[model samples]
Target chain A: MATRSRALLPISFVVLLFLLLYLGLYLNPRHESDDSPMIGKLAPEFDLPDLIATGDRFSRADLNGQVSLVNVWATWCPSCRAEHDVLMRLAATGEVPIFSINWTDRPDSGGSREAALLWLGRLGNPYQKTGDDGENIAGLEWAVTGAPETFLIDVEGRICNRITGPLNDRPVPNPENRQEVRNNVGNIMKTVRKMVAGEGKCLTQDS
Target chain B: MPYSRFMNGLIELNKGLRMMQKQLIKMVYLLLLLWAPLSAAAPIDSLIFETQLQEDRFKQLVQEIRCVKCQNTNIAGSNADLARDHRMKVYEMMKQGKSDDEIRHWFVVRYGDFVLYRPQIEARTWLLWGLPLLLIPVGAWLLLVQLRRQRVQATEEAPVVGALSESEQKKLDEVLK
Candidate 1:
């Protein structure tokens, strides 16, 4: 009987180990929701004190009136710097007003508010209004995963497009991958122009 | 004869031994149940540490090389899921105790040196590594060219200053005034 119990010991351990391994596989961290975390959602609303003003506040109302582009960026994000020229050109063109929502710019995480301000000053501000989202309250609402994200919103405040990562208006040696970004940006601008022309609803009923 | 008493004592001892064995079996079963959930959560902490390590290594690597994807933005910050997965795979290899050279070699064997966040110091990558050393002279030459061009343009465009006539400037100034 003692020998029989000892024989069962190894078998029990093998069973236990396999169970844990399967559990880990089942618990694998990935998307747990059905939503795209972007499409079919209202743009995140925020009202925060302006970084540049003492008593004044910057809110969603600041984004009201006409279509706009919201660029979420940070000092720590290298791509944000890469897209600086493209944003400057977009602002310079004045085809659409660009707004900036600075995300997670606290100094403790290697992103400093001072650094963000200096970056804008040195690079030239492309944003009509800038809001400091130092704690990332706005980021959570927008489901932002990283920096250098640009969103195109219609005049009625509905998000029409989202471009992840940095924008490069400059030429590249490869043309194949370039089509994706170029096409997305082009479609967004075309839609924005149409919205401004008062041809249709800012958002389709199904959209 | 006291044989009856002896038989009773022997039977009692057997019962106690059986009870001890039953309790031991129960304890074993209990341990198995507890270990299952504990080990499942273990890998999450391990993976989180690996992710942090990957970020540190990525910064160290990208400073030494250009991004293969898009003309701008290094491999470190490209939002392409491929870049993110590559970083994670590097962490996984590191966790498995693979040396940095071995990891770089694995990438070179598959995607070639272009996949390397930092191109290795080899004959094929010699120019890539050598470019920064050669850049100082090249950059100076470019700067000189740009400054000279700017100086020429400034002189040429000086007469075009009337492009902003005083009356228009004064009118805009008056709005501020």
Candidate 2:
């Protein structure tokens, strides 16, 4: 029995090593461990003029008293364009209030307030309120690598989650690959519902 | 006579091979010289700093910070717009008299610990920082085990030094009988 256990030791170790590597495959670079550290922290403060209404200001305090979504969008970002419909679908549900930051709306980035106005005019605006960020003053604070990142903020103005890529609800055709797939909108809705039930503080993800 | 000629032919063939190998090595070295600039120097030459101290700090900070967009590259080496923006931010902060720690902490707040090139020795990074120290003891233990095995093998190979002679064996047998 001692010899048998001794033989099984290395075998069990190899099995564990293989299992770790297999689990590592699912732990992609954008895995939960790589999730933004801004989670569970107060939303970064920024006071900007409204994207549509000229006189109105939108700031961190505006996000208080309710759970809401803050999406970063720009005309130059095609992914933002692609996910506009998802945001529209999500907005129609009235599950949560959706706000936006018109990130990098400057001439150099091929985006301007007029272009944004035209795009929203054509595409139908889903944002409840849009903050103009021509100089990307807020983007730097929010750690925005690029446009089209969405944030979920709780009632107290703490960030609950941050979605890095375009939100999608498309079905994964292969069931076996489901573990790697992100049902972004569905998951966001689930989190939103849980938050509405008063549990929106960012839960520690066990990655 | 023919065997010597064959030997001479083989010698000439070897000389030719050696010459070709030398030429190939020279070509590779020349190609590598040309390839060096593209990887080492990116498009960050346009940035202007006020003083040498500020410039030095900017350069150091850029290398010490990771480019979120590129993930693998330090911000100094990445040509991505975000990296460029980060470089500008670092320069701006330095001009405003922000300390290095403050600038680094600012980035940490925005981008998290991943932004740092050298992560802090915290609970999450204890394994990463302590790995080299951990390897020292492990290596010492492995060497000890290896030395012990070698010593065992050495002792087994050496013949018994004081074996009984044939006369002694016979005397012992007679005594026993």
Best model per DockQ: 2
Off by over 4 Å in 1: A1-35, A171-175, A178-187, A199-207, B1-177
lDDT of model number 1 = 0.67
lDDT of 1 at A172: 38
lDDT per residue as tens, model 2, B1-177: 999999999999999999999999999999999889667767645767788888888889999999998899888888777787888898889988999999999999888888999886789889998999999998899899979989999898996779789999999999999
Best by TM-score: 2
True contacts kept of each: 0.00, 0.80
Chain A TM-score vs. truth, each candidate: 0.72, 0.80
lDDT of 2 at A65: 84
Clash count list over all predictions: 0, 0
Chain A TM-score of prediction number 2: 0.80
| Model 2, span A101-195: residue lDDT tens | 99987887888999999999999999999999988888898888887788888888998777777888764423454422443677667777877
Error of 2 at B92 (Å): 2.0
Residue B88's C-alpha lDDT in candidate 1? 54
